[model samples]
Target chain A: MDKETQPPAASSHPRHHAVPPYLLAAMAACDGAWEAPESMREIISSQPTLDKADGPVSVTRTRIATRARQTMLLDQALLHERSTAHQKLTWLIEPTGRLNRIISDAQGVEITPGTLIRSEGQKPSADIDVNRAYDGLGHVYGFLADLFKRNSLDGSGLVLRGTVHYGEHYDNAFWDGTQMVMGDGDGEIFNSFTSSLSVIAHELGHGLLQYTTNLQYQGQSGALNESIADVFGALVEQFVAGDDAAHASWLIGKGLFTKAVTGVALRSMIEPGTAYNDSILGKDPQPATMAEYVKTTEDNGGVHLNSGIPNRAFALFAKALGGNAWETAGSLWFNVIATRTLPENADFATFAEQTLLQARRDHGAGSAVESALKQAWDTVGVVPRLKENDDE
Target chain B: MSESLRIRVVRSGGVAGISRRGILELPAQEPSGQQDPDWFTMAHQALNQLRSIQEPATAPAVRDAFTWSLNIDGEDHVVPDQLLVGPARTLAEHVITLRGSR
Candidate 1:
């Protein structure tokens, strides 16, 4: 038979595994079915291997050996066992040292993981976002693992995926339930999202919240979600810069805005309502206290707006503690989100109560931690719930 | 609902964060003797198609994303990232595009 003819055994399965050009001739010369497991064959065929000889592409389709079937069955059982093991370890509990990241170039389009320019363990690319995303994700992973003693976002070392240069003149970054997406700014109001480590951390913080507390994305709960992201965002920045809470700027997106825009930063945790005050962007509408809380149907019930209350509360709580926010205040916040005590529909009042509970539980009743959390919440006018029955 | 339908579509959130709403009201039900069966069929078909679509799972809501809230008669339905698909999508495009002119 000619080398171009496909073997009868291979034709039966119709699932052709790509063979090396040399292997194709050899397999054709043999005129026999190849012996390999179905799953292993699939694994081999998916890899990109060159055909040394420029000829008709070769493929292997063959019968599964008895032992090979057993191995495949064992592999399936092992996969099931692993799945079951991790299923119970939900809430970002798994610790994976290897920070796997994938950076995609959106190419002025709004698509995810658009064109894969970089992958885990690969060297950096010429694109600034590729290298920046890789480094930024690495920094975040290190911060969480080294400081928090936790794994990546979702706790199982979830593959951190990022798309940079997403959309033409896009002006923002977001964590869309899966990966961190960055946009090259219009250069007038904003810069590259990767320009600030805090921005990256802030977006990743959303992922952590998703895998952890999963605070409702509307009203007070939504604000809490945003606040958690901002808090950790600042913590990530401080931890990386080795800055204490007092020294930390507590700005959510410090360098995100360009000089042309009249803004010190996007949002300020230290002084909630003072992030930015500009003509083009309008005045910063964040309210620092419950008295100044904005009641609006917009921005997910002013999530990004009212978050200032808790943001400032956290800043105060951490500053009053007189140390790194990530060490004391940050740990408490992480514990509040990581534990199952936090409900999906938790409001600011409930969150404060939980923080107080965690503080008392962690540091004993009437401890400094408990008082600091109480004072912070009280200062912000968020009265901690006495109990679930009487508070609401 | 009352042999008539009123739809108010509100498009909110985006880069500019400007919100706009437009209302499209269908004529009330004609008496049985005066009813146009073909017109009723068309109206029922359009409304059914619009209400049948459920938002796709895994459809991410990106930054500066647009969300749509459709108040049909009295019941309201909100779709994050506009949940565009089929007749509902076509109607939303028209409602949002022509919101200012109306």
Candidate 2:
């Protein structure tokens, strides 16, 4: 952030804490303690019945709350951010009534937001893509606002502007820095890009990333950018379905293609390289581990392909925690971006380390959140440099 | 113009990891003001068109994005993917077909 905009560093900007107040106090008191006291282990484990019950969710809710506070702290760096927190000691309040939707038509051309077909508080257009786009925007915005207290794509109500039917036979969707553009596929291979909630949220996720770290759109960093989009995109889908991480499909662009294409989705977070296998679109070329990472000078250094590694790591992490993926896992990843702890050109190792640090901060030292994140990165073969350095 | 205006498009990155360049290079010029009159007029027109454009700021980068760099003579202009239009669009499509990476 520019010097003019930086907030003074303090613990005084109180709103809400995802990590419970008592836990933060205990963590502060314990200081160097890695694991919780033996008596608290079951609570930290987070299963209610000892046979899988939904007891006090405040433990999970508190961790989410702590990260929520961290998120607000970091978000001051980007855009005109207002704290989306509720009163001092309350859980996050919902952004139920504030939505600014603007849907437009490109008329099969490239003109941006071609004609304003639907504005905020207006009725849905007759076009399916327009309605789908509008609903998708609401879902994602609701996810961030409700879960993380993020106001919008910019952490302030940046109008969720979108244009549908952009260019004939066009087969992609993108955020052009300010607004979104969706394409109607060529009908033979793929359907309209707006068919998938993940696809729409994925494009909007780019807007979120842009406002934060603005990770350079090339090489490994670009892959992280793509992976971040896919990660949050899947979260949006999972959140709307009310699915826990275990129940979530972990597919990035499911339902985007036609049946003739012989593919399930555009990308898969859980199983990279296996999302599609078609005679026309070739194969899904993502690598799930660094061992198979593609070294290329194309796709901005295989940003779309190699993103699968981190994508899988995020999926594994959220599933291991076994709850709403948006709560803990989402907070850690969002912290990495919002904190600017990772460099603009950060590699997978760098990203993994920042997440680890966030896990330690929001959760206690050596907490299960930290353990899950560590295992997730390790399973994907992304051993963080900081971990190795600490081990040394 | 037909012989001298080489409309080249270098397409980089799409679904497939493919990079291809197509050059419709027109004559560099036999510029003593002595050439086929029609061709000379076309070349001047193309040159004027090229000189008229000042490349705009870069557009937001997209995943599996196809970036088109149009090089005319020695002057090069990078066309934002969403904004490719007019003669540039016509030329880019020709290049995409030529490379078969469309």
Candidate 3:
């Protein structure tokens, strides 16, 4: 036969092997409803025995093995589908809910949510760390809600989750994208992470930024992220104590260090580099003004170091207003974020401009709030550009 | 077969945001008479592990997490604290704690 006119080979036809209806149903459910044969038997036995007179029940050994194998395959397929669907669901869910909080214990290992020790509305546990985490989360949630009208970090009632006692002598606390992880500290140099309220609030602030501008954590933008978190930390401490800006300590991690260390706290917002000076820790390298803006690649371009510039500016602005920092200053900053005009890689100058615009909108043109904000940015040597640029 | 090995470790970014550095110089191959220190084996193992798993090109910044920069011999490897594990972790801890134990 001519090649052009030749009939198609039988093997070349697309195969349409039929999938079992039961498997299709199981896959559609994808909820692990199909258990192992042994488990199914147990569940069956738990129910009333079907009529015993139904005949000899010819369940041959070979037949049972084949059924068990089929069940195993279905179970595996269901499990895989369940896992995939779970990932998709997690991505789709907006994480909206009430003020829900979950605290777990890592038990001195590098794991998170290791053991669920406490949940919302549960009684306090014997472990003080768990209680502290629970209470701290509550305080932070209250601060955000009462002051900024923010439901939670995401402004959508996202559940606040924390893991305490994360690692042996971990000596640190961090936000690991999904939740907060706190360490017990090495004791020689530092104390328990939960000992400071600012630390807890600061971690949550990162989550807030994640849901907000989602700022790029590098160089100037990274410094803004750290600075905003510190701002939230200080504000929460002040709000809880009912202390005004003047009375507030403006310290980020006070009482976080052991007596063996000479540091009063991790970072001082009002006076950035003055927070610590020790033989072991050296000296805090944060610069309080743009004149001293550090330029480096380490620490995400010295995020913690250069945040001092903005930190001091905020402290100055609050103190200049001379009342509850959370009232005008806090509201001003929160409004800037709520506006959502900030780009992911917004620079210091860009943020300073937004604060100016926000101040003008809230307090009117050339108001005292705007004046203080301008002076604050000027003191830090960050001059907002005359023309507003697109931050999209 | 004796060779000298020098390693420098610079640790930055914790809750404190303090930067610390330490350097260690020890014989790489076992010396003729004296036995190698514990860090000697750890250093070799860390380098081997680094070779096995090359440092990731990009790592998401964890809040208040430490970042370590290691200078072994003359080459440099910057590893985030979250990724520092096994022998590499032990060696980094030892260097930071002892601050050049010889």
Candidate 4:
């Protein structure tokens, strides 16, 4: 048969448009019969108006069918892109160990470890370990680019920059508006922050949130921002390692803790207590429930501590949804953050409501997104409006 | 005489004004008919318990009182008054030095 003339294989799945058996099953359940074209049309037409109360049911059905058809086309486009296989590319490095000079059409940019040349008072050390910082940044950058089609922290392809070994045995890593900074862990309880991929991803994720939602850095909204980073960071690690939610270890800093510290992990996604049993660190200090919620002043008004509530919620949601965390749960959270309409001070209840709304919009009202979102919030004691009665 | 496994606990990383080194030597000789399955396991558990007692904010203060136990040949030895140095890497290196028996 001529290459272009050959008919598409009937049994063979399309590279991009091939819907998973589960999704297909769900679509079938929405109507009836696996291959019923008529039911598929009905489900597709109704999807859009499902969120609206007064929209005609028939109109909604037609909208759902139309959307399904569009999604199938988008899937085909995604498959084609994958089939082309974007070549892994890199930019040339200068003699001073910098990619300062960007060559034409460079696929990736290099960030050099440097001191804050512009900071006036109390200039910290610039003697950063370039190799470690580079690797960490590179891994996070590659993750965003490969998975989400994100060019850089901002979708417009922002230049990535990092400073390593910032202070004398600095114990933390943080993103300072423009660039990411890593501290050589005071060789005791913690190691170099750049050593863990999750940490790097976590930091970069902060940058991503800044560019996207710009969530305020205090109270529940700030906690939500931090939690989003933690979720995405864990996902980046899991995605790179090709591990599912069940197989993945939800610890934020698995290797950062020194050998002297006897802890399973820094933070546990599945079971928060399992992260650390140490007396010095005070048993991970993370509460999985609102009842155990900590009201504190430290760590940016307990931004890090209170984050566990939302973090655990996301983890439970992903596990309940099953399969890849990034594919379903991750996408839902990302969409919520990306499309948030509330101010930065939005509380947990507000965030939960918005997430439920977004999930319903993205995936039908009573779809898997609804159940997963309900299950996740319920697990964390933040019952959504629909399931408030069911929650105990 | 049985081979002795000397496991050292090196402490590091905390605020200034704290000594950051300690060593626990576990002698290899144990009573006959008894076996210490995994020395590291027991030592780690003890270390974790010690860590949880220290407040994270006052890590430097607690570092001054750095202590740990090692199980060699079925016996536990507690090392006390350890120094808390710059970071985990330094402590790890110090532990290596103690393990080297130099």
List iRMS for all predictions: 4.2, 3.7, 1.4, 12.7
Q: Lowest-scoring 10 consecutive residues by lDDT in candidate 4 chain A?
A: A89-98
User: Who is ahead in lDDT, 1 or 4?
Assistant: 1
Question: What TM-score does candidate 3 get on C-alpha atoms?
Answer: 0.77
CAPRI category for model 2: acceptable
- Root-mean-square deviation of every model: 17.8, 12.0, 18.0, 18.9
Q: What is the Å distance of residue A50 in model 2 from its true position?
A: 50
Model 3 CA deviation exceeding 4 Å by range: A1-96, A388-392, B28-38, B52-61
What is the TM-score, restricted to chain A, for candidate 3?
A: 0.74
Residue runs of model 4 more than 4 Å from their true location after superposition: A1-129, A385-392, B1-102
- In the range A1-392, model 1's lDDT, one tens digit per residue, is 24344322222222223433233323322212222222223434555423334334322221111112222222222334575664532221233346889888999987776998999889879888779888889888988876655568765567889889988887667777788888898898888888888888888888888776677777899788788988888899899899998899988778878998787788888897777777666677789999999888766777777889999999999999988889879977886776546677888888998888767655667898888889899999999876743211
TM-scores computed on chain B for all candidates: 0.63, 0.56, 0.77, 0.29
Better of 2 and 3 by TM-score: 3
lDDT of 4 at A55: 40
Encode model 4's per-residue lDDT on A262-335: one tens digit a residue: 78656776776567766555466667888887775333345666678898998888888889988878877765
Q: Compared with the true structure, what per-residue lDDT tens digits does model 3 show for residues A9-99?
A: 2122121013232332222222221222221343344544223232343222222222323333233323444756554322111123568
lDDT tens string, model 2, A75-193? Answer: 33222233335233322122223679999899898668698888877787788999999999999888887666667776555679999998888766778777888889878777898
User: Best candidate per lDDT, number?
Assistant: 3
Query: What is the total number of backbone clashes in candidate 3?
Result: 0
